[model samples]
Target: MTDPDGPSGTATAVPEPPEKAAGTRGRRRALRHPLARFLLRRVLIAVLLAWGITVVTFVLTNLVPGDPATANLGQRALGDPAIVAQWRQDHGLDKPLPQQYLIHLGGMLQGDLGVSQQSHRPVSQDLAETVPATLELAGAAIVVSLILGVAFGVVAALRRDRLPDHVLRVLSLIGISVPTFWLALVAFYVFFYRLQITPGSGRIDPGLQAPPPVTGLATVDSALAGQWDVFASAVGHLLTPALVLALYTIGLLTRFTRSAVLEVLGQDYVRAARAKGLPGRVILFRYVLRSALVPIITVAGLAFGSLLSGTVLVEAIFAWPGVGQYAYKSATTLDLPAVMGVGLVVGGVYLVINLIVDVLYGVIDPRVRLQ
Candidate 1:
C-alpha cells in the first residue's frame, strides 16, 4: 500500500507475492507444531528429572542406616574405637554430608563408581562385569513381552468376548497376581526340577566354555566372539529366568494394549475404514493399531522400567546375574559404594529406555515428527 499524499506523483508499492507469504506461514506453522514443542519441553523436563533423581538417590542412599567402615571392620576394627574413627576419617566418611555428596557426584560424573567397602574391589569393576548379563536378559524379556503381549491383545480385540479373549484375560490376571519371586520358584521347580525342560540357574551352561573375558552380554558377546556353543548355552539357560521376569510385563502390557485397542476400535476413523470395502484385518491393524500404539507404547515403557527396579526378587530367586542381586547383597553387607553403584546403573537404565521410547514415539507417529 502507498501513502495517500503523493497518489498522482507516485504509485503505492504492492505487497509481496502470496506464495512468499504462504511459504513464511508454512515455516511458522512447522515451527509451532505441537509435537516439536512437546519434544523441546520434554528434553528440559528430562534434565530436571535426571538431576532430581541423582540428588534424591544420593541423599537417601547415604541416610540408609549403617557405617561402611564398621560394615567392613567388624568387631576387630570396632574393638579400638580410635581405629574405627581413624578408618572413617581416612575414607572421608567422617566428612560433612554436603562434602561427601559433592565428592560422590564429581566421581559419578567422571563415571567412577567408588570402591565397595565389603568386597574391597572397585564398584565400577563389579558393575562392568555384571550389568551386561542383566541387560541381555532384561532386554530380551521386555522385547518378548512387548511383542507377545501386543499380539495377544490384538487377538483378543479381534475376538472380543470369545474363548481366546477369556483365556488371555485369565492368564494375564494370574500372572499379575502371582509375586514374581514366588513364580520364579514355582517355574524353577516345574521346568527345571521336575520336567528338566529348561535350566534353572546361571546365564550359560558350566560345560560350555565361557569366554576368557566375559565382555558385554554373555549371549551377545559370545555371538560376536563366534562362540556358538556358548551362545546356545546362554540362550537355553536364559529362557527360564527371562520368561519368569517377562510374565508380569506381558500380562500388564497385554491388558493395557487390549483396553487401548478396544477403545480405538470404537472411533470414527475405525468405523469409516470398516464402512469402506476394506477388510476387517486392515481396519484393525493398519488403522486401529496405529491409533492405539501411543498409549500402549507408554504403558509398556513404564512397565519395563518397573521391572528394572523390581527384578531384585526374581534375581535372588533365580540366581540371575542381575544388578538386583548385587544391590541386595550390597545392602545386606551395608556396602555404600556398591549400593550407590547399582543405584546409578538402575537409574541410568530407565532414563535411557524412556528416552528411547520418546524417540520411538516420534518415529512411529508422523505428528510427533512434525512437532
Candidate 2:
C-alpha cells in the first residue's frame, strides 16, 4: 500500500505468504463444514446432559426406601444385621453418597456398569444382552408406523374433506386412544388363543431351537445366521408386539403428517406447481410432500426415540427380553446399578437420535444449516 499524500513518499505493501493464507482458508473451511461444527456442539452438550442424568439417577435411586443391600439379601437376611452390613460393604453401598457417586461415575467411564445384586452379573452385560431386543422391537414398530402413517397421512391430505379422510381421522383417534397393554392382550387373546393365527408371547416358538445369538435381535440374528425357520418364527413372534407398539405412534405421525402436508399444499410454490398443469401425483409428491417432510421427520425421530425407552409395558406383555423388561425388573427389585444403567442407556439413545435428526434437518433444509 502507498500513501501518496504523506511526505511525497511511496510505500510498498508485502503480501502474506501463500502457505499462511492457505492455512487460514483451511481453518475457515473446517469451521464452515455444517455437520462438523454442529456435531461437535451437540456432542459437548450431550456429554454434560449425560453426566447430569447419571447424577440425578444415582441420587434418586439411592433415595428409595429399600437399601440395595437389603434387597439383595432378601427376607432371609433382612433380620441378620451382620449379613446385611457385610453385603453393603461388599457392594460399596455402605460408603457415603458422594463417594458412591464418584465411584459409580468412574466405573461407568471405564465401561463397568457394576454387578446386579440379583443376577450377580455385570449390569453392562445384562444391558448388552437385552438392549438389542428393545432396539429390534422399537425399530420394527417405527418402520411400520412411518410407512403406514405417511401413507395414510398423504391420502388423507389429498382427500381433505372426503369420506376416506374422515374415516382415517376416526381410525387415528381410536389408535391413539386405545391403551397399549389392552391392545397387546386383546391381540394375544384373539390371534394367539382363539384364531391361532399369530404366535403367543415370546421371541420364538418354544419347540424350535433358537438361532445362535449374534445381534440379540432374534429375527436379525436368525437371518444373519441363515436360519430360515428361526427367522420365520422370530418374525411371527415379533409382529404382534411390534404392531401394538406401532399403533399409538402411527396415530401421532398420521395426524402430524396430514397437517404438515396440508400446510405445504397451501403454500405458493405448491399452488404454482398445480397451476402449471403438472401431473397431480407429481405435484403432490415432488412439491407438496417434499416440502412437508421436515416436520414429519422431526416427529418421526422423536416418536422413535420415545419408543426406544417407553416399551416397558409392551415388552412385559409380550415377554420380549428387551431393556424395557430388564428395566422393569430392576426398578421393581430396587436394583440401583441396573436401574441407573438403563436410565443412562435410554437417555443416551434419545440424545443420539435427536442429534441424528438435527443433522438430517440441515441436510433436508439448507436454511437450517445457516441458522
Candidate 3:
C-alpha cells in the first residue's frame, strides 16, 4: 500500500488516534515485561496440565474393575435389581462412558466432585474434611527437610572428603534406602511404645476435643484459639509422623544440594571471590548458594509434591485423618469419585509447586524470565 500524497506533493500518512496509540503502547509494554510473559506462559501451561489431569483421573477411575453400584450398595443390596439400577442411574454409572465422563467433568468444573460411594457424601466435602490434615503434615515435613537438608548439605559440601561429609552421605543413603512403612513402624515403636517420648497415632490427645475447624490444622487452629494445651498436643502428635515422612525427602535434598553446591563452588566466580579476600560466609551465601538455588528449588519442589502424595503409609501408621488414609479407604472400596478427587488434588499440588518453583527461578535469575 502506498501513502497518499499531500497537496504539496509530499507523501503523508494518517496518524493513529490517541486512545489507539495508548492501547498499543500498553500491549507493547506488557509483552516487553519478561516476568509478565513468563507468568502468562506458565499459567497457560498449568491450565492445560490441569485439564489433562481431569481427563486422566476420570478415565483411570472408570477403568477400575468393579461396579460402583455394587461396591457402594453392598452384598445385601445386590439381590434387588431395582435398587441396584436406581443406584447406578443416580451415580451416572448406567450411562455410556463418554456421557458419564462429560457429566463428571461438568460437575468437577462446578466444584462438585460427585458422591463418594463408600462414604455416601460428596467427594468435595470429604476432601475438605481431610485435605487440611494432609497439608499440615506435608507442610511440616517439607519445612524440616529444607532446613536440615540445606544445612547438612552445605556443611557436607564445605567439608568435602572429611568425616562429617562421609557420615552424612552414609546417613542419607540409609534414609533413601529404608522403606517408609518400616521406618514409620520403628519410629512409632521406639518413641511412642518403648520410650513413650511421643504420642502414638491421631492428630491430638484422645481426651481433648479438637479446636474449631478454622483451618483444619490442629496446631494452627488451637493456637489461634489460644488453646495452648491443644496446640502442644497437636505438635506432640505431629512430630513423629512428620519426621518419618520427611526422612526420604531430607535425604534426597541433602544429596541434591550437596551436588549443586559442589558444582557452584568449583565455578570461576567462586574462586575469584575467594582470591579477593571475601569472607567465607559471604562467598558461600552470596555467591555459592545464590548460584546453586535453581537446582535446589527444582528438587525441593518435587520433594514437596512427593511428601503431599506419598503420605499414605505414614498417615495410616499415625492414624492421621488425612487425604492419604482417605485415599487408601477409597481405593480399597473402589470409591471412584473419591479416588478421582484425590488424584486431581495431588495433580494440582504438583502443578502449583512447579509454578512456584518457576516463579522462584525468575526471581533468583532474571534470565529465567526471558526464557
Q: What is the C-alpha local distance difference test score of each model? A: 0.81, 0.86, 0.89
Candidate 3 lDDT (Cα, 0 to 1):
0.89
The digit string of per-residue lDDT tens for model 3 on 1-371 reads 12222232331255666686566667667767889888888889999999999999889888888876766786888889999999888777888999888988899899999998888899999999999999999999999999999888998999999999999999889878898899999999998999998998999999998899899899999999999999999999999999999999989989989999999999999999999999999999999999888899999998897787669999998999999999999998888889999999999988899889988999899777777
RMSD value for candidate 2: 6.7
Task: Identify the candidate with maximal TM-score.
Answer: 3
lDDT of 2 by residue, 1-371 (tens): 12222322221244556786566556667767886677667778888988888988888888888767656676878788998888888889888999999999999999999999778899999999998899999999999999999999999998999998999999999888998889988988899899999998878999988888887889988999998998999999999999999998999889999999999988999878978999988998788887788999899988987676558988988889899999999988888889999988888888778888887787777787766
Off by over 4 Å in 1: 1-41, 212-215, 366-371
Candidate 1's TM-score = 0.86
Q: Report the error of model 3 at residue 225, Å.
A: 1.2
> In candidate 3, what residue range of length 10 has the lowest lDDT sum?
1-10
Q: How many backbone clashes does candidate 2 have?
A: 0
Worst 10 residues of 2 by lDDT: 3-12
Residues 1-371, candidate 1: write the lDDT tens digits: 23323342332264546786566556556658767666666677777777777787789888888777767886887999899889888667888999988898888888877888767788998998778878877888898899999998888877899999999999989878888888889988998899998876888876777865656788777888898998888888888888888999899888988999999988999888877979877887799999889989898889888777657877787788778888989998878878888877888777777887897798678877764
lDDT for predicted candidate 1 compared with the true structure: 0.81
Query: What is the lDDT, from 0 to 100, of the residue 12 in candidate 2?
Result: 22
Error of 1 at 26 (Å): 19
